[model samples]
Target: MLETHGLTANYGQFRALFGVDITVAAGECVAIIGANGAGKSTLMRSIAGVIRNAAAMVVHRGEPIGALSSAEIMKRGIAMVPEGRRLFASLTVEENLLIGGQARKAPGPWSLDAVYQLFPVLRERRKSPGTALSGGQQQMVAIGRALMSNPELLLCDEISLGLAPVVIRDIYAALPKIREGGAAIVVVEQDIGKALAVADRVYCMMEGRVTLVSKAAEVTRRQIHAAYFGEAA
Candidate 1:
């Protein structure tokens, strides 16, 4: 469970997010969809504590964590698969995954074997350098790396970016298993169809604010189109 209230972030004088509010319940999957420069990633970074803000702005469960460091947030049961899938270039695939659990060693179902089960290809390429893998395999490694932490909340920023359609589908197919472990997920995605397919609810942002929040099954294409582009529709 996570909530953001009146959340705002700035890069010097230029503000990126303006009072963007959103919430994710335990085991719930929430997707954030927007065009480029819409602040979806900004909101993810803020929640992950990559961009510091007021202490009371972001809350995990019931405690404020806006000002906490990224490591602190990860320690508090939140792990992020960042937009670029920033895996360690020098580490082997298995080693990269090992680093994720090293930071916060908590007992859970996600272990090296569990991750390999989730992505069988990862098991085959366990000894390969992380950067040596294909984009899809690399993404799997990123997701697996995050899962190694056994987080209660998973922040996925652009998980589907730059992947082939079949690969994206393969990545999303792993979500049910992730949820089976009771981890709430926040997915920031540009692919509206994929986001809607995997999320229970969806939030659409424009500029720096949430313009629409609706159940994935209930929101229509016209509504999302309007919300995405700031159009009257």
Candidate 2:
């Protein structure tokens, strides 16, 4: 449902992406894996409209949306759980989830109860300030907040960063439910194991380009290592 064609992006003159092409089909889970500075996050930002590109660069269902504002892209059914889980510090936990749905309220399956169901702790701490929560809780809030938008495509950037293995597992365990709710997911992750466990397809990037793309079961560890570091076996 989302695609990029010859997508190139730049911050002023320093180019970050080189003819990057990727695709995420409806209800499929795609994982993007790479090391730091490999342009994984850059690609996510470009697709989310945080970094503007030429009209022909990014496409949503065959329409050029590269130049659209982030809000515009969001309205077209794309939502992002950014790298930092940028929740409003002043808002309550429940309030954060509420705001995610503000942009497009013509909901399909996500609601406050559903979010709470996904992460039960969120319901118990619904009134607490978002920043007051633990890191795991905050991450849960971030994921729930994105789901509140009822988006067709969900972009998860570094969702496992700085979290414990069990916590990451818990977060990923919710993926089946999210997929059941009908959203395509693009997970940008550094933890290869977690990404491979949940992804139907995986793409490994290195130095601003995709070096490997394969079905999750089809890729070997050696290939992943090579793609991740741009190294030879």
Model 1: CA > 4 A from native: none
Q: What is the Cα-based TM-score of model 1?
A: 0.98
In model 2, which range of ten residues has the least summed lDDT?
99-108
Whole-model lDDT per candidate: 0.93, 0.92
- lDDT value, candidate 2, whole model: 0.92
lDDT of 1 by residue, 49-108 (tens): 899999899998899999999999999889999988999999999999999888678788
Backbone Cα, N, C clashes tallied per candidate: 0, 0
Clashing pairs in 1: none
